[model samples]
Target: MPQPRSTRIAVIGDIHNHWNAQDHLALKSLNADLALFVGDFGNEAVEVVRQISTLDLPIATTFGNHDAWYTATPWGRKRCPYDRDKEDWVKQQMALLDHADTGYRHQDFDTVSVVGGRPFSWGGPEWRFTDFYGEWFGVHNFEESAQRIQEAANAAAHDTLIFLGHNGPTGLGKEPEDTCGKDWRPIGGDYGDPDLAAAIAAVKASGKSVPLVAFGHMHHSLRHTKEVQRTRLCIENGTVYLNAACVPRIMDTEIGTQRNFSVVTLQENQVTEVNLVWVDEGLAIASTECLYTTMKVTEHSASV
Candidate 1:
């Protein structure tokens, strides 16, 4: 039997513990084949991960830097909101996810495979948490990190791949408002993961068709200027890179409470549509803003 050629993917960006029963219900109503999560599910939030674990759809997730926020550094540990010694929040969250955690790994579907970039990455040129990486992944440096990601891509059973990461790969843009650009002071520099970029090159060199790369660390709202939002979509080298970090994914509006989800449609092994959608409490699509299409970037794509 021939497999279906089209897949609708719903990306629930950096949760930061915003997930609830309503979001879960909204996801079920969307009719998406797969749900992608870019982590930051709230400082190693075990409860949030537990809720995510019960979702009834296929999923691929990569842990964000915030997943390891409290465990990565001495300062963070000192300020941990939860008791570290009594309960390992990170371990519990990972355990809840099981195979859903795709960092340095790949999850295969019928037609396409979702491969992961580095997990728990702060997304920059610098390597911040060596000890944490060494203990968990045995990856000591950027080279090893690149190798791990590339190896995962190479192991994919399918040629059509979607690379998911906590943060995007480098070289998309250098401006603070770029998808993965650094927005803090000394702002004008790439804040994407270099290892992920290396892995992408390797994957392409090995002849895999990379349709899309999705991540969420840099929020869409710009810290530099409220006049403009971050670049949420970038198309280059036969790939579509997206920043799905729609902060406060749950927002209260005049109409009612709206939940956001970045939806990407893959057809014939190509990204055909990308949109930032908002769903009302009734699970109805309240708003739809098209960000990308096979033909052209729609008017809705303008700094939205």
Candidate 2:
């Protein structure tokens, strides 16, 4: 019998309410079986979701801090002023696409199975403030979110497990360039979420092999320093962790500024290729790098 084909997945994140013509062009190029967005759809959440839905490809997403704030009571209106109305509309649109805003959800397509959610992380000081606001607006807490992830992992029915999240699991590194990197020069420490890290650890400990873990939220901040500025994809203990937070700042995008995203190929339940791509403002491919490839699933972790 002829062998089944590989599955292509597109990983993108930090869409801060901007998906222009160029972005559309870039997405079309991937021709992926599915696209996973890690969150932060911004105030124009409704419009953006509608636009993306037009692509007709299945999309899976987790809400980010910015996304939570869009529906946050007094805080949301004070920050963006679009609030409630737009948030409601966005939820309706998400339902149409058969996507849950957050929590444990799974899907099986061909040879792959995916579990995705926006974890409630006990983040840094600023994030705590956002968490409090999130609570008031009906967002899940750390413990609750952790339990969901664990259950999802336990119930997964496929060998090729793909985990999707907004904030990455902790312990990747302490360097600013790492997935959960932090600069504690003055105070000194890691900035990743302990809850997320612990949950992931438990999942791995359960013996379920997670081939790819896609996340965003820890973006490279150009304002502070340029030390950690680029797409980060690392393989550790047979699991590939990808940090998809491409936007380095909150400012409006410029003409020549490039957007970061990734394309992953899985064949016969093993990851065969990963491409870290950057698209220019004109919808042209600015750069593309095959970060990793393996003929067999037994290959060890390697950083590129």
Candidate 3:
């Protein structure tokens, strides 16, 4: 367990099957006390989830829209890649995590706790996929879904909570490049989950200290243009909302192919620093980009 003064956490953004053994090694090299995964292992990517299960560390995760790609819609159900899917792939992934899935639930760690929003979400103002949430989460509408999320927060063991989700909550922004904004064609609208938004508001109103809300579905690389990258960090009411989806997390740098992971550190139950560190082939930090910070890392307590 990490000390209260300092807790180091590694945040994995949307993994659209861009994970492998190297990622595990990279994460280990960082020595994060806890790992928070924001979901999207792949399109019902059982093999990918299996790979993640073998990791030896404390983890809290949820499903992304891609995690149920094949089964979420009629189009996908018809052509599920896994012929051996004798069981639901989503369940398979959930079991693979040892039930560490935090969607509409809470995972308590040493100091801070993780409360999840809706899992397997495709963010938007309108709800399109109904059967998926109904069957898996037993949530049919935003009201019920919001209640579940709030219940998780209400049950949290710690005052400082980290809300993890596949897509970010609403009220961040509606611009195309905003954290959870819609970047596709008619580019400009809040692509955040309404239920998640409501739950977050309710949780904050209940007087809990929400340090961060991290997720990754909106890729950093935008579809509209390359002139500007998507805004990945938002600070509102003392909570930091981050989008860790640096797509193609495995990329070829000038030195070699590097793996990316968001390194976040909290001190005194408040976020202090965040960085997107690129680990090289040798499993050493090759480069780093400071995403957000309030003080020097050394100012915090011992980073477990």
Q: Ranking under lDDT, best-scoring first?
A: 1, 3, 2
lDDT string for model 2 (1-304, tens) is 9875888988887888877666777787778788887877665366676666666676666666665454444566566654455356445545644553334556655565677654323244233544443553343455655666677766767756787777777677665555566643453245566556666778778776677888888775533466545336777777778777767422234556776778888776657787777767666767776767775322223353
Once superposed on the true structure, which residue ranges of model 2 sit more than 4 Å away at CA?
1-4, 72-77, 83-97, 100-102, 119-141, 183-188, 227-231, 248-259, 279-284, 295-304
Against the hidden reference, what TM-scores do the models get? 0.96, 0.77, 0.93
Tell me the whole-model lDDT of each prediction, alpha carbons only. Answer: 0.90, 0.64, 0.86
Error of 2 at 29 (Å): 1.9
Segments in model 1 whose C-alpha atoms lie over 4 Å from true places = 1-4, 299-304
How much is 126 displaced in model 2, in angstroms? 9.9
Error of 1 at 140 (Å): 0.9
TM-score of 1: 0.96
Best by lDDT: 1
Query: By descending TM-score, how would the candidates be arranged?
Result: 1, 3, 2
